[model samples]
Structures are given as structure tokens and as C-alpha cells.
Target: MRYNKEDLIEWIIRERQPGGQMFERFTERARKVIVQAQEEARKLNQNYIGTEHLLLGLI
Candidate 1:
């Protein structure tokens, strides 16, 4: 599988939908950290950015 910017953006949008699923507001730095996690997942040939990637990005 391959990861790309467009796909990642779509995933992020889906993850942030209404109804209290995952609609928490994020700061600019938080958004950047999410993007970085996505990049790291892609670099490692993974399709999704899991907890480990997010933690690594935040650290």
C-alpha cells in the first residue's frame, strides 16, 4: 500500500467528524505533529499513523 497527501488529508477529515467521535480542536503545533506522524508512517511503509508514530512525533 502507498500513502499520499490527499489520502492522508481525507483520513484526517474523517477522523475529525462531528457527533463527538474525534472532533476535538487542535492547535497549529498539534496539527503539525499529526502531519509529521503521518509522514513517519509513510516513510516506514505503513498505511496509517498509529499511537507509536504519534508519540514519537510528539516527543
Candidate 2:
């Protein structure tokens, strides 16, 4: 897993962006974790702050 966005950004920064493919690798539960992580990274979308319900639903 990536430590921070700087790491993610540095890793993803490229001449041609084939993005969003990263998310495709996630299972439903794993995807939820990633979505929550991404929201926390942005400091936006407070809905992801309380994402346990998503975990419960997915599981």
C-alpha cells in the first residue's frame, strides 16, 4: 500500500495517464477501503469518514 499521495502521485505521474485502472483491481470491499482512503486524501466527501456501513454492507 502507498504511504501517501506524494508517493501515489510520484508513482502515477507519467507522460500518458492510464488512470482509474488502479481502482479496477479492487474487490467490492477493497474498493470501499480505497474510496475511503481517497476521500481522506482529498479532505473532502465527509461521507467516506464513516464508511463502516459500507464494510458491513459489502461483507
lDDT winner: 1
lDDT of model 1, residue 49: 78
Error of 1 at 10 (Å): 12
Q: Candidate 2: lDDT of 52?
A: 51
Residue 4 local lDDT, model 2? 90
Q: Mind giving the per-residue lDDT tens digits that candidate 2 earns over 1-59?
A: 53897876776774222325666666766767665555563465454435654444344
- lDDT for residue 56 in candidate 2, whole number 0-100: 42
Counting clashing residue pairs in each candidate, in order, gives 0, 0
- State TM-scores per candidate: 0.55, 0.35
lDDT of 2 at 21: 61
Error of 2 at 54 (Å): 15
Note each model's CA RMSD in angstroms. Answer: 9.8, 8.8
Output the lDDT of residue 53, model 2: 45
